[model samples]
Target: MASNPPAPEAPFVPSQRSTEPFGSGSYRTDEGPWEEWNPTEESLRPVRGRHRVAKQRGGLARSSTVLGVGVIAAVSAGGMASANTGKPPVSISMPDLPSVGSLLSDDSADAAEAPTAPLSGIGVTSADTAQGTTDAGEALRTRIMAQAEQQQDQVDTKAAAASAAAAQKAVADAAAKAEKEAEAKAAAAKKKADEAAAQKAEAARLAELAKQYTLPTSSYTITSTFGQAGSMWSSGYHTGLDFAAPTGTLIKAIHSGTVTEAGWAGSYGYRTILTLDDGTELWFCHQSSISVSVGQKVATGDVIGRVGATGNVTGPHLHLEVHPGGSADGIDPMAWLQGKGLTP
Candidate 1:
């Protein structure tokens, strides 16, 4: 659809045979043609309407204009193909046409004087025509590359967020685990400290109670224990602890108490009953003599009586009984003495 300017024509040269004067009615040509020259208005009239020329195909005309146009078309097509396929443009070579500039007639020379039109459409600038790159195609490629870059950036941002969240979660989990371990250690230490404190308090309480109590007698040996199964007394079992000793062995008040009974009768001879402040009673039975009288308050370790074999006795010993709250049934005297921090 596009073309180049036509080439200039060569100068005209008349043959030697056609050199006769213009007044003659005949003319001579190298081809032996004779023609009469007449100047008339009808013969010189300009042609009207469009004149169609036959199209040349299969081969190019031996004209420099045609060759230039073919070369331009081939180069344009190659550039377009290279741009589309992202490949280099192929080189195009024009065939040599000998004496092509001299072959043009006067009509071609006139056409060569006309202005040449652009190969592309209107509004195409000289800068746009370089490298055969169209405005529309370049714009499309630019937009596509920009979109691809944007999508890649979005993917990278999401990946970074996920990684940060995972790291934060790991830190939180570790902190929680450490806190739990610390709490457990603190609790264990507190429990151990409480147990040690309890043992120290118990020891201090026993030492204070030892100051408030004393043993009933010294230089004595245990002959019978409470709860022994034997036919030794009126009761079916022994209800008192027997301390065997030499006669006249002094017995002392077991604790700070008032003497509730002395000079007892019947099975208990010379028996002395000492009542403690808490209404618990200590009975010293089978004594050799009674030194405490009823209603007399005595301190701990004060002499109360002596050991002897009296009524319902088997040998020279003192029978001791303990009655909590003055109850008729008595508990084991050895256990009560140990409760007061006394081993015997």
Candidate 2:
């Protein structure tokens, strides 16, 4: 603008930085950016021989700290690993090695010292680490085994309790079943006894009823009986009882009843029927004489007829027949008489 700003005054230029080293008596500057520097004869002269010696000492100090710390760490790691795995430690060699106790001693001056001897001179054995690891491993194994035993004992106790409960339940069930069976047996026995007692009571009642009746005739020979096979009668088998006697022998009533029938019954000859109150008819057949009339009442042992050789008679005898409800077929007269308490 104004004559091109008077030909821009020459750009500001700074002096070149000099990299010459300081005097030997001066402290060095190591914190700054590096620059190419040239040493002076005065600065190099003082450190020429002693410098290498100091560096060697420093390296030894560093190695002692590293080796001491590494050995402790390796030992500790090996012991822990061995204890966990239940195995021996891996072999690691340390030359001219002192005891760990001495190396780790609280004295700072002693820990600063390094092993001065060569690698093949002395060392710690692998057996030392193995011994320590074995002791720790055994302790751990004992603890584990103890815990396992305790758990097994607990399981056994629980199992025993359960078994006892099961046994008790089985016993109770068996007892209940037995009790039910016993009750059933008792009921069956009681039922059988009651049935027997009822039968005995019925027999006693029938026996007392027998005492009230008597036989129809006496002092006569039993020539024939009911159900006897004979061609002398018309009905295949004898249907009445025959008491043989002389003609005009007396016949009597077996029980007290009215005379519902008293007349000649054809093949029955002269017959007299005495019907008891219970509708049982007593027939006196082949009679020589009839002494009772129809509608006449009679008593037990009353004479109703006499023995004679009447119609259908093989001999002079009294034929007695029993007809329940006045039906044609009659039962055995001898059994009927016995049932009526007479043993003819």
Candidate 3:
């Protein structure tokens, strides 16, 4: 190859003076005898001194490119950083720079002209871009707040529903309890009404029976009740009701009956037994005299005997006993008379 046109002359650059002392064999001026120099860690170590860097043709453009790249990186990561850290967003500052096309081209004239734009206008553009980032962050925060509010509303709605359900359940339970209570009260009232009606009917029946029955003796005072315990009675208990009256007080038939017996008895003295149509025997014992003979058919209230103390030797009275179907065992005469609607 032809010798490269003669290596171009290097451009002149002024050198800065150092304040450090020179080595023993070193020269301070350019015209001195030169010595070889070697750099070492000790020599290269930084010292406390004012230092200055000389500006080069494209230095400002390179610095602007580096700062712009850093600003973009911070902007891109801003949202995520704020979200992750849960901290306030920090402001990013962007310095003025040459235009994008000027930075990419090697044309010195374009680079020089790019920075000539008004700084205020460039500042406004940078401010707008920063504001956009700030707005984006604000929007994210608002969306998060809105989501939180929505979640809270959901919780409140569910709670309200549960409360309403509980209230309704309580109301239903109360209604059921009240219904049961009402039923119980109604049943009790109905039972009471039925019992009262039954009692009324019983009273009317007894009234009708009284017409077909009569007392065994009139104007007689009751002296003893049936089933009275006493040593004087042969069976250790008095088996009949005693009606006391003057001697010869006429005893009447208790109902329409036929005389089954009329004669003297051992301890009973004179006795008369009337057998009713239903086969119930009424005994009029301790009588002074019996007016009816055996087999005599008698109507209700007909005279059958007279009060007496014929044998047992007590005051004058009619001892009355009742036997169902003429059975040997006698029942309470007082109760039997009551059943026939005869008080005496």
Q: Write the per-residue lDDT of candidate 2 for residues 1-344, one digit (tens) a residue.
A: 45545565653233433244434454446422233233344544342221100112335566567667887888887777554542445566332332333333444454355333322323323664576578889999999999999999999999999999999999999999999999999999999999999877856755665555666666799989999997878888999888898898888887789998888888889999899998988888889899989999988778998988889877899888899998989999898877654667
Native-referenced Cα lDDT, model 1: 0.74
lDDT of 2 at 307: 87
* Tens digit of per-residue lDDT, candidate 1, span 201-258: 8667766887878888889899899999887678889999998999999999988999
Candidate 3 has what TM-score? 0.55
lDDT of 2 at 266: 88
TM-score of each: 0.46, 0.46, 0.55
Candidate 3's C-alpha runs over 4 A off are 1-166
Runs of candidate 2 exceeding 4 Å displacement: 1-211, 220-233, 238-249, 313-317, 332-344
Measured by TM-score, the strongest candidate is 3
The segments of candidate 1 whose C-alpha lies over 4 angstroms from its true place after superposition are 1-192
For each candidate in the order shown, give its overall lDDT on alpha carbons: 0.74, 0.72, 0.74
